[model samples]
Target: MARPTIYSDDIANTICEQIAEGRSLRSICLDEAMPAKSTVFAWLADSGRDDFRTKYVHAREAQADVLVDEMTDIADDGSNDWMEQKNS
Candidate 1:
């Protein structure tokens, strides 16, 4: 029997939008509204849509930059302990 589809363009778009907004894909996928992480990975790697793949990659890169910025902030902040760095 065929498996139920846990993915759709609307869901994909929402994931991409979350990434664009500096959210982690893992965290986004963990939400009950989003699909499984494996499903999202399969979609990105095999969906055969250059536009969507490119957009997702770009958003991922942006999110990486945001993470680095946050790390830098935590390091520069003498007020917070090493483990006390911001959650996001």
Candidate 2:
């Protein structure tokens, strides 16, 4: 027997949107009662949604870059690490 079709593009798009909104994959899967995480990831990775994946990856990278810049600024100011002199 042939396997069932578990996902539609519309549904996949909705799930991807939720993920892009900062929702956790586990949470979306649980809420949607999806069969498996791999199923959702596969749907996202499909060729039809390549644009979505590219946009999502770029957004995440931008967020990471902002965080790194903030950390670097703090470290340069010596506020990220400080050592106190101890008397023996």
Clashing pairs in 1: none
Residues 1-88, candidate 2: write the lDDT tens digits. 3322376656656665665555666776665444367776675578886775776576456556666776778778965577899999
Task: Return the number of clashes found in candidate 2.
Answer: 0
lDDT (Cα, tens digit) per residue for candidate 1, span 1-88: 3322455677777778889778988888777767778877777778576666887888888788888898999899889554657778
> Residue 11 in model 1: shift from native, Å?
2.0
lDDT of 1 at 72: 93
Error of 1 at 28 (Å): 0.9
lDDT of 1 at 80: 57
Using all chains and alpha carbons, the TM-scores for the candidates as numbered come to 0.71, 0.44
Q: With candidate 1 superimposed using the best TM-score fit, by how many Å does residue 84's alpha carbon deviate from the native?
A: 18
lDDT of 2: 0.62
RMSD, one per candidate, in order: 7.8, 6.2
Candidate 2 at residue 68, lDDT? 75
Residue-pair clashes per candidate: 0, 0
